[model samples]
Target: MITEPLEGFLPLFRSWFDTAAMAEKVGVSGSPENLLVELDLGPMVEAELRLLNHTPANAAEAACMLEVVRQNMGDAGRSDGLDLRAVAAVQRWLADQSTNEAEGQPVERLLRRARV
Candidate 1:
């Protein structure tokens, strides 16, 4: 979905689907009773979400995203550094994805890729 000035994110989708026997139908498509695959989601997002017990990331300033970016951009000096910029970017993204918005907002999605 990224188009302008794109950046790459590491993929960390779920490993197996048959490992867990789900009682509810979490599949958005395909056969509900028989899962064809597990949910796939960004690794960083998955970590943060799991800690929150699936709670949506709140606040316009996401510490987790900024930290991840900082770690990824480590050792880069001011001319090549991005600490401040990354934090700002995460803030903007979180704001745009706020669930408290009026309606039809792009809230943060909790999607985890699964394989069955």
Candidate 2:
């Protein structure tokens, strides 16, 4: 099924990380497995969001998606696999999301790290 909705894979990611951390805290034997599907699906979801011109539903979602874009963008001068149009759309949407000073910092920090 399509999990591209704002409430989909992102939340799953958060949950998985949280669960993993808790498991580790309890001295679990191993970390969460990096399933091949999960690894492969990230790029597909990223591409879908970019091509569809997806806008985040809220500040939290924006922040999350911005990270996705940032990772896809990589460090300075590394395009990775993201296209110019997609990057521009992501930038415009992210710019429109910074409604307050507190929220703006994360966006700025992520952008700086991503160099996008």
Candidate 3:
């Protein structure tokens, strides 16, 4: 189950999924080549769509959506396929949602590893 804060963050995160000019607002500059954009996002598109449509039935379901977004975004960042700023934003949000120390550790570890 997610807390109020986590629940509230869903809309904000969903707004950042735009692939057009909005990408610039999210700190990703330069337009992607039309033909390559789909391939660039790869698996992230489906997860992003789920959030965009608010399809998650509950907090746990929403968290799963975030996990999918996080993993795919991180993978995209590796080859400059996606923007790190967006990935960092997602990581920070995920880390901030942890209700306790134990719950936060894995997220913190991922954040640390990604930064390295």
Q: Model 1, 22-93: lDDT tens per residue?
A: 312353355655453455534433443332221113442244445444544553623433444555455445
Provide the overall lDDT of each model, using Cα atoms, as 2-decimal numbers. 0.35, 0.47, 0.46
What ranges in model 2 sit over 4 Å off? 1-5, 12-53, 75-91, 94-116
Better of 1 and 3 by lDDT: 3
Best by TM-score: 2
Model 1 alpha-carbon miss at residue 10, Å: 1.8
What TM-score does prediction 3 earn?
A: 0.24
Better of 1 and 2 by lDDT: 2
Which model scores highest in lDDT?
2
lDDT of 3 by residue, 1-116 (tens): 22233354455454434443244345443456544334365434543543433434455545645554565565563353333333344444455454333344546666665676
- Between prediction 1 and prediction 2, the one with superior TM-score is 2
Instruction: Please identify model 3 stretches exceeding 4 Å from their true place.
Output: 1-7, 19-116
Q: By lDDT, highest first, what's the ranking?
A: 2, 3, 1
Per candidate, the number of residue pairs that clash is: 13, 0, 0
